[model samples]
Target: MNLDRSIDDYLAHVRTERGYSEHTVAAYRSDLVDLAGFASGRGVEGVAGIDLALLRDWLWTATERGLARTTIARRAASARGWTAWLHRRGLIAADPGLRLKAPRAQRTLPRVVAERALADALAALADRAAGDDPVAVRDAAIAELLYASALRVSELVGLDLADVDRRRRTVRVTGKGSKERVVPYGAPAARALDRYLEVARPAILAGVAEHGKNAGGAAAPTAVFLGVRGGRLGVRSVHRQIAAMLSSIPGAGPSGPHALRHSAATHLLDGGADLRAVQEFLGHASLGTTQIYTHVSAERLKQSYRTAHPRA
Candidate 1:
C-alpha cells in the first residue's frame, strides 16, 4: 500500500476501533505525515521502503534537529504502531519498527497548586460570581468542578446537562479512551454548578438569543459550559481561564486545567484517600499512571519538613 493511504487507514482504525481521542490521533497523524515527507525526500514513497534502518535514521535526524526527547519518543512510538499495523495487514513482510527505539522521555512531576492557594483562588472566583455575571458564574463552576472532580479539561468541556446529577452531587464523564465514570464533587462545587445552571446559563443563552448571536447554534444549548457567544466551551478557552486564574499564585509549572487535576489528586492523597480509589476517581486505566501523585505528595512533605524542622 502507498504510505499516505496506509497512514490514513491506521488513523481511522485507531480513531474508530481503538477509541483513541482526537488529540492522540492528531499526534499520530503529525508524526506519520512527517515520516512520509521524509521518505518522499529520499525517493522512497512506498510502505515497503520503510525499513528498520530508515526508521532509525528518521529518529536520528529528529535528534540532530534538536527536537525534545519527548517529541522524538512520541514520534518513534507513532511510527512503531503504524508499521506494526502495516505488517499485521500483510502490507509489509516484517515490522521494521519492532526494533526501532528512541530515548526514553523524562518523567516530570505534574504541577500541584498548594491547597491554600487553590482555595483562595476559588474563593475569589466565587466572590466575582456573586455579582451574577453569567460568565463569572460559569467560570466559577468550571474551576470548582475541575478541582473537585479532578477532571481533564476535555472531559469537563465535553459535559452535557444530562450528564450531571445534582441531587446525587455526581457527574458522568467520558474520559481518555472513551471510558465512562461517575465522579462525585463536594458541596461547594455542587453549589457553584447549581447557581450556574439555574441562573447564569439561562441568562447567557437568553442574552445570546436576544442579540441574535447564538454562535453555537443548536449545539450550544445542551453543553454544561458555554462560551460568551453561546457556543460550547472549548479546550483552549478553558486553558486560558485556568491559566489566568493560576497566574498570580506563586508556582512553577503549567497553569492549565491539569494543574488543578494534579492538585486535587495530591491533596486527596495527603488527606489519606486510598490510592486505588483515586486511581478510579481519575478514571486512570493504569494505577502506575496514578502513582505520580504519591511522588508529588512526598515532595510536598519534604518541602514542609525542610521549612519547618530545625534539624541540620
Candidate 2:
C-alpha cells in the first residue's frame, strides 16, 4: 500500500478500535504526517523501508527544533502507533517505533483550591450575586455545583433539566466512553440548584416570549445553563466566567474547572475516601491516574505535621 494509505488507515484504527477521541486522533494525524514527510526526505519510500534510525532521526530533529517535551512525546507515540499497525497488518516486517524513547516531561500536580479559600470565594460569589435577580441565582448555582460535584466543564454545561436529582443530590453524567455515572453534590449545591430550577431557569429560558408565542404557550427548548443568547453553555464561556470570578479569590491558585475537580478529589482523600472510589468519581479509567492526589495529600499532611508537632 501507499504511504498515505498506510498512515490514514492506521489512524482510523486508533480512532475506532482504540476509542480515541477526535482531538487525540487529530493530533496523531498531524504528527504522523510530519513523520511521513520527514521519512520521505530521508529516502525512506514507505513502510517497507522505514527503520528505527529514521524514527530516531525525526525525533532528534523535532527536539533540535525546540518542540516541547509533551509534543515530542505525542509525536513519538503517533509514529510508534503507525509502525505497530503496519507490522501487525503485514505491510512491514518489523515495528521501527518499538524502541523509540520519548523525551521525559515534567509532571505537574493538578492545582487544587484550598478548603478555606474555596469556601470564601463561593461565599463572595453569593454575596455579590444575592439580589433576587435570575442571573444572580443562576451564577450562585453554577459556582456551588461546580465545586460540589467536580464536574468537568463540559459535563457541567451539558446538564439537562432532567439530569439533576435534587433529592438525591446527584447528577447523571455521561462521560468519556459514554460511561454514565451518578455523582453526588453537597447540600449547599442542592439548595442552589433548587433555587435555579425554581426561579432562575425561567428567566434565562424566557419561555413564552422569545419563540413567537406558541399557541399552547410552549417555548423553544433550552439547555440547562443558557448563554446570553439563551443557548447551551460552552466551555469557553464557563472558563471566562470562572476565571473572572475566581481570579481575586485567595488560594484558588491558577483556577479553572479542573481546580475544583482536583480540590474535590483531594478533599475526598483528606476525608478518608478510597482511591478506587475517587477514581470512579473522577471517571478516570486507570487507578494510577487517580493515585496522584495521594501525593498531594501527603505533601499537605507533611507540612501540617512539621508546623504543628512540638519536637521538644
Candidate 3:
C-alpha cells in the first residue's frame, strides 16, 4: 500500500511482464519518483492517498516550475498508469486517474538534411574509407546503412553478423516493441558494408585475437558492428558519431543518427514513394507516426515555391 512500494512493483511489472524497453522503464521511474516526492510533501505517503486532485496539482506545480509541455504530459501519463495499476491490484478503492489530463506536447517536424547535402557528406566519408582504415571503413558502413535503411540507432547497434544478407542488400533489424523487420539498403550502403566486412572487420577481429578477447570460443562474435575493444558497439557510441557528423552540417533540431532516419524518410516521400510503404519500411506501428514525413515534404515544397515564385 506504500506509494513507493507500489511504484516499484508497477515498474517491475512493466519491465518484466509488459516487456517495455529499458529507456521507457527509466522514464517511468523518474516520473513516479518525482510524483512520490511531491505527494509526500503534501502528507500523502500511501497509494490510498493518491487522488485525482493531487495528480492535477502535481502537474500544475510542474507547469508552474516551467517544465516543458512534453515533460508534463509524460509525467501525467506515468502517474495515470501507476494509479490505474494500483486500482487493478485492489490497493486503491477506485482509479483516480481515469479522467486525468495534461496539456498536449507540441509536435515538431524532424530535421531533414537536404538530399544533396547528405550525398555530399557520404561521398566524403566514402573517400576517407577508401584507404581501408578500420575505423573509417566501419564508420562509412554505419552512416550508409543508417541513412539507407532509415534504421534506429538501437537497431543498427543490435545487428548481428547473420542478420545481414549482403547478396540481397537487406538487413534484419529488431525495432520497438521487439518487432523484427527486414529492411533493404541501397547500393552505396551495400558497398560500404562489404568493404567493412571484407577489409576492416578482419583487421578488428585480428586485433581482438591479439588481445585474447575472443571469448565467444571457436565461433566469431555475432555482432555485425564492433567497438575498438572488439565488443558489440553501443547505442551511445553511435549517437556520438552521428551527432559529430551532423554538427558540421548546417541545420536545426536534432543532431544525431535519427536525423539520418528523418532525412531518409523525407527523401523517400519527396521522391514519390507511397506513404503506406514508407510506413512499413520504417517499421512504424501507426500510419499517423509515418504521416509526419508528409508534413516535412509539404513544408519543403512551400519553401521551394516561395523561393521560386515571383508573385510571392
Candidate 4:
C-alpha cells in the first residue's frame, strides 16, 4: 500500500478502535506525514522501505533543526507506534522502531497560581458576573468549575446539561479515552453554575432565537456552555477567555485553563489530600502521573522556607 494510505489507515484505527483523542491523533498524523515526506525525499516509496537507519536519520534531522526535546520525543513515540502497528499487521517483517530512542523530555513544574491571587481573580470575575450579561456570567461559571473540579478544557466544554447535578453538587464528565467519571464541586462553583443556568444560559439562547437562528421551536442545545451563535462552546473560546482573565495575574508558564487545573491539583495536595484520591479526581489513569503534584508541593515548601527562615 502507498505510505500515505497506510498512515491514514493507522490514524483511523487509533481514532476509532483505540479511542485516541483527536489531539493525540493529530499529533501522530503530523509526525507520520513528516516522516513520509522525509522518506519520499530519500527515494523510499513504500512502507517496506522504512528501516531503522531511515528512522534514525529522520530523528537526527529533527534534532539538527533544533526541535525541542519534547517534540523530538513525541515524534519518536509516534513513529514507534506506527511501525509497531505495521509489524503487528504483518505489513513488515520486523518493527524498525523497537530500537528508536530520543532525548528525554524535560519535566517542568506546572504553573500554580498563588491561593490569594486566584481567590482575588475569582472574586473579580464574580463581581463582573453579578450582572445579567450572558457571556460574563458564563465566563465566571467556566472559571469556577475549571478550578473547582480541575477539569480539562475539553472536558468542561463537552459537558451537557444533564451531566450536571446541582442538588448533588457534582458533574459527570467524559474524560480522555472516553472514560466517564463523576466529580464533585464545592459550594462556590455550585453557586456560579446555578447563576449561569438560571440567568445567562437562557438569555444567550433567547438571543439566538431572536436572530432567527435555532428558531421554529428547534430542540435546545444540550451543551452546558454555548457560544454566542447558540452552538456548543468551543475549546478555543474557553482558552481565549481564560487567557485574558489570567493575563494580569503575575505568574510563569501558560495562563490557560490548565493553569487552573494544575493549581487545583497542587492545592489539593498541599491540603493533605491523599495521592490516590487526587489521581482519581484528575482522572489520571496512573498514580505516577498524579505524583508530580508532590514535587510541586515540595518545591513550594522549599521556596517558602528560603524566603521566611532565618539562617546564616
Candidate 5:
C-alpha cells in the first residue's frame, strides 16, 4: 500500500480506537507527513521501501538541520509506532523501526511561581473582579480554577455548566483519552465560579438572546466558559488570556495556563500531598509522569538552604 495511505490509516486508528486527543493526533500526523516527504524525495514511495537505515537517515537529517532534541525524539517515536502498526496489520514483512533510536530529549523542570507571588497575583485579579463586568469576572474564575485544580487549559475550556457541582466543590472534566475524572476545587474557585454564574454568565447569555444568534433554539451552548460572542470559549483564546495575565507578573518559564498548573502541583507536593494522590488529581495515567513535581520540590529545598544556611 502507499505510504501516505498507510499513514492515514494509522492516524485514524489512533484517533478512533486509541482515543488520543486531537492535539496529540495532529502532532503524530505532522511527524509522519514530514517522514513521508523525506522518503518520497529519496525514491522510497511505498511502505515496503521504509527500512531501518532509511529511518536512521531521516533522524540524522533532522539533527543536521539543527532541530531540537525533543522534536527529533518525537519524530523517531512517530516512525516507530507507524512501522509497528504496519507490521501488526500484515502490511509490512517486518518492523523496520524495531532498531531505531534517537537522542533522549533533555527534561527541564516546569516553571513554578512562589506561593506568595501566586497568592498576590490571584488577589489582584479578585480585586479587579469586584465589579459587575462579565469578562473580568470570567477571568478571575478561570485563574482561580486553574490554580485550584491544576487542570490543563483544554480541560478548563471544555467544561460545561452541567459538569460543575457547586455544592460539592467538584467538577467533572473529560481529560485526555476522553476519560472522565472528578476533580475538586478550593474555596476561592468556588466563590469565583458562583459569582460568575450568578452575575456574569447570565449577562452574556442575555446578550446572545438579544442578538438572536443562538446556534440552536433550545440546544444553545452549555459551556461553562463563553466568549464575548457567547459561544464556547476556544483553546487559543484561553492561551491568549493566560499569556496576557502572566506577562505582567515576574516569572521565568513559558507564560501560559500550564505555569499555573505546574505551580499548583508543586505547591501540593510542598504541602505534603502524597505522590499517588497527586497523580490521580492531575489525571496522569503514569506514576512516572507525576514524579517530576518531587524534583521541583527538592530543587526548592536546595534553593532555600543555599540562601539561608550562611555557613560557607
Candidate 6:
C-alpha cells in the first residue's frame, strides 16, 4: 500500500483493535502527516518506496532550519515508531527509519551570574523585604534556596512538611528523570529560609482560601516557597521575579531562574570543587552534561589572559 493508505489503515487498527486512546491516535496521525509532507518534499511518494537515506535527508533538512536537538530527537523517534508499525503490518515490509540518526547538537555553555553580582542581588532582596512585604520575604528565601542548592524551581516549590533539615542545612530534592538527590545550602540561605518560614509564609497564606492548589496549606506546611494563594509556587512567578532582580545586577546576562542554577555550578567549580563531585551535586545523568561549566571557566581564563599577558 501507499504511504497515505497505509497510515489510514494503521490509525483505524490502533484505535479499534489496539484500544489506543483518541489522544494517542491523534498524536500518531499528526506525526505521520508531517512525515508524509517530509517524504513528499524528498520526492519519495509512498511508504513502500521510502528508504533510510530519505529519512536522514528529512532530518538534515530540519537541522538546517535550526530545530533544537531535543526536537530533532523526538521527531526521529516518532518516525521510527511509525515505520516499525508499518513493517509489522506488512504495509512497507521494512522500517526505513531504524538507521536514521538524529544529528547531535553541541551543548552550549550555560549563562551564569557572576559571584559578586549574585551576592549583590541577594543583598538587594533584604531592602525589598524591609519595606514590609511578606511576598518579598518569600521571594528572598525562594531565590536563595534556588541558587544555594542549584534546585530546579519545581523541586524548590514541591517541598512538603518534611523535605528540609534545618539542622543539616540540606534539602531532599526530586530532580529530572524522577531521580532524587539531597543538596546542601549554607548559613546565608538558611537564614533567609528561616525568616520566610517564621515571618512571611504565615502572612502570605493568611489572606488565601482553600482550593485544589492550596496543597501546601494555610501555614506553609513544608514548602520552602509558597504562592500568594497558599499553593506551591510556580515556575513563571519565580522566573519573572528572578529576571527582574537579576537584570538589575551587572554581570548577570539577561535573567531567568536558570541563571541561578548555572551560577551555582560555575561558582562551585571555580571554588576548586572536583568536577566529578560537582557532577553528582548537580545530579547530572552524565558527566559530559556537567562538563559544560568548564567552558565558563575557560572564558574567564581568556579574559584574565588578555588582560595580564603583557603581549598586546
Number of backbone clashes in candidate 3 = 0
- Where is model 5 poorest over a 10-residue stretch in terms of lDDT? 212-221
Ranked candidates (TM-score, high to low) = 1, 4, 5, 3, 2, 6
State how far residue 158 of model 4 sits from its true place (Å).
0.4
- In model 6, the runs with Cα more than 4 Å from the true position are 1-70, 77-95, 209-222, 250-254
Instruction: Give candidate 3 regions above 4 Å deviation.
Output: 211-220
Instruction: List per-prediction Cα lDDT, in the order shown.
Output: 0.94, 0.81, 0.91, 0.94, 0.92, 0.80
Weakest 10 consecutive residues, lDDT, candidate 3?
A: 212-221
lDDT of 5 by residue, 1-312 (tens): 998999999999999999999999999999999999999999998999999999999999999999999999999999999999999999999999999999999999999988887888888888999997898999999999999999999999989989999999999999999999999999989999999989998888887778865655443379999887788887898888788877877867898999999999999999999999999999999999999999999999998999999882
Q: Can you give the lDDT of residue 140 in candidate 5?
A: 93
Residue 100 lDDT in candidate 6? 76
The total of clashing pairs for model 4 equals: 0
Q: If ranked by lDDT, best first, what sequence of candidates would result? A: 1, 4, 5, 3, 2, 6
- Residue-wise lDDT of candidate 4 within 15-37, one digit each (tens)? 99999999899999999999999
User: What's the residue-level lDDT of 259 in candidate 5?
Assistant: 94
TM-score of each predicted structure versus truth: 0.98, 0.84, 0.94, 0.97, 0.96, 0.74
Say which prediction, candidate 5 or candidate 6, comes out ahead on lDDT. 5
Write one digit per residue (lDDT tens) for candidate 2, span 1-312: 767888889878887888776667888889988988998887776679888888898999999999999899888888888888888899998887889999887677777777988898888878866776777777778888888887888788878878877777889887765567899998888888888888777766674357633444433354677654466667887887788766876662567777888889999999999999999898988999899999999988887899999981
Give lDDT: candidate 3, residue 305.
93
Put down candidate 1 lDDT per residue, 133-192, tens digits, no spaces.
Answer: 999999999999999999999999999999999999999999999999999999999999
Per residue, candidate 3 scores C-alpha lDDT tens digits across 1-312 of 787888899999998888787889999999999999999999998988999999999999999999999999999999889988898899999999998999999999999999988888899888999895898899999999999999999899989989999889999998887789999998989999998998898889888779876566443379989887788888999998888777788989998999999999999999989999999999999999999999999999999999999996
Model 6, 1-312: lDDT tens digits are 677887788888777877655556777788677778888876767788778888887778878989889778777876887788888877777788778788665566778787888888899997797766899988888889889999877777777658888999998987764578988999988998888887888777666644444555554545667787776777789889998888776663547888898999999998999999999888888998888898898898788899999992
Query: Model 5 compared with the native: what TM-score?
Result: 0.96
- Quote the lDDT for 146 in model 1: 99
Clashes of each: 0, 0, 0, 0, 0, 1
Could you say which candidate leads in TM-score?
1
